[model samples]
Target: MDPNIQGGSYDNPSQAACAHGHYGVAKLLLERGADPFSQGGRFTNALQAALFSESEAIVKLLLEKGVDPNPGNTLQVVAYYGFEAIVTLLLDDGADLNIQDKTHRNALHEAAMQGSEAIVNLLLERGTDPNIQGGAFGSALQAATYHNREAIVKLLLEKGADPNFQDVQGGLFGNALQAAALRGSGSIVKLLLEKGVDPNVQGGRYGNAITAAACNNCWWDDGREVVTRLLLDYGAILSDAP
Candidate 1:
């Protein structure tokens, strides 16, 4: 039987084996000429499938078989999933930590969004800039604040993430303060404010921090109210509202 034969929900036997963490089967397929680079499945390739399967052995096998560790947001995906060992392997094999996905987010952004503190720390310690803005949240700080990842937020700030930094491309939350407001994360909002983030720095969908808080209709009745008060206390300009 041809090892590259496409079947099941995978593009090829190799992909299926890798996706299911069948290391032995994947090895056999590769040995029989299954192209590790064959692209088509939901994961785009066998190496990515192995990543989804969270199988380090299969990942190492594919890498040894000539899979490019730098492609397909490899580092970002592992960082997002908190696969610390896999992340280390990819980095060691030359995966670019600063490589942004289609959404323009680097590994730091993914780690921040997923609250993966260890990954975040690793990326930071490895020299991943905490403020390479462009993603949906503009910056890692905004992403962390939006997701209420307090520890990650603080970490990024300490590492030189600009609290007032807005993505030059313009994003949904504009700045970290506005992001916290939209998330109804009063504590994060306060943290940013205490860090000296300008509460009136407008640009996002809601324009400013107060407006973002006002527009937050979360399930918790006091969520928006709490954030609004925090924004106000920090001197969010009412004239800049919306």
Candidate 2:
């Protein structure tokens, strides 16, 4: 039996300490060479563990121990969860804002989907591409629209996000307008329409927003009527002749 317990469950002692916010124990483990940058765990590493522990002290200690901040979507995780302090600390510690996760979504996309206006604005201010298209919802505007995050949608639009941007990689929602219509975001739908979204533009199963609303299957009853009227107001052609 070794004094440094490293031969048990996948949960290492150092990681456990960090996750539980036991700062002194974590320091002891690191003194015993417990690999602060250990790869592959629930939180990925001690820094991530500390970050999720909601302890600024632990996070600061890990950073002092030279833990890398941008390891495998850590920044994305913080941004998605709207961990403002954690995001601010990571950014100060040199986390790469443009690092893409498994879904090819960057921090901006995650922030947008989660309706995190503060984090989204911070990312944008730090130079995230507003029109970066590759995630599950294509552009950040499309992501915000899919999740019906109207505030984020408005912010993205104001920052010059493309409304017509299509999710060619994901392919389910297509452009921001179609995605909003399918999910029944009348406000978001109205915003995109006001921004000049071509209603007849073809994409997704419904072909167009008018058809998406008329189908009455993809959307719920909550805002279906409002979206339909809004689309009609924006000059959506019901015939689908395009």
Candidate 3:
């Protein structure tokens, strides 16, 4: 049988084996010269398939076979799922931390959005920039804030994340302040305010923090009012809201 013969639900045998965590089969196929870099299936390649399976052994086998760990922004995907072990493996293999996907989101942004504190800490300790802009939530701080990951939000702020930083790519909430306001995260909004975030820094779907607060649907009217009041107290300009 040709080792590289492509077929089946996964488009390739090696990818199927890796995706299903059939470690022994994946090893056998690789030893028989199956192309580890063959792209298909739900994942981009065998290495990514291994990641989906959470099989560190198969990941190591693919890496040893010289598969690109960073293929298809693999680091970002791993961070999104909060796979700390695999993330460490990729980083130790020298995967590019700065690589962003179509949304311009790096691994750190995914980690923050997923509320993966350990992964966020790991990325930060390894020099991942907290203030990288773009993606659905702008910066990692904004992602954490919007998702109501208070601990991650505090951690990002402690790691020197810029409170007033706005995404040049024009994210939905513009900045962390706006994101927190829209989510009705009063604690997070207060934290950002204390950090000196400019409540009126414009340029997002809602234009400014006050508008985002006005659009809050956090299921708690009091929470929205709290966030709105917090924004106002922090010098949010009502006239700046669109």
Report the lDDT tens digits of candidate 2 across residue range 1-242.
Answer: 23245534435777778888888988877887777777655666778788668777778778878988878888888888888888988898998988998878789988998989999999888888899876777788878888889999988888878887866775566888888888888888888888888877787656777767656476476788898899887787777633
How many clashes would you count in candidate 3?
Answer: 0
Error of 3 at 147 (Å): 0.5
**After best superposition, candidate 2 residue 19: deviation in angstroms?**
1.1
Instruction: Assess each prediction's global lDDT (C-alpha) against the native.
Output: 0.85, 0.80, 0.85
Candidate 3 — what's its lDDT? 0.85
Candidate 2, residue 68: Cα displacement in angstroms equals 1.6
What C-alpha lDDT, on a 0 to 100 scale, does residue 161 get in candidate 1?
A: 91
User: Candidate 1: minimum summed lDDT over ten consecutive residues — where?
Assistant: 214-223
Candidate 3 Cα deviation (angstroms), residue 44: 3.3
Local error of candidate 1 at residue 54 (angstroms): 1.0
Q: For candidate 3, what is the TM-score?
A: 0.92
Kindly report which residue pairs in candidate 2 clash with one another: none
lDDT of 2 at 20: 86
Candidate 1 residues 45-112, lDDT tens each? Answer: 99889998999999999889878998878888898899999998888787887998887878888899
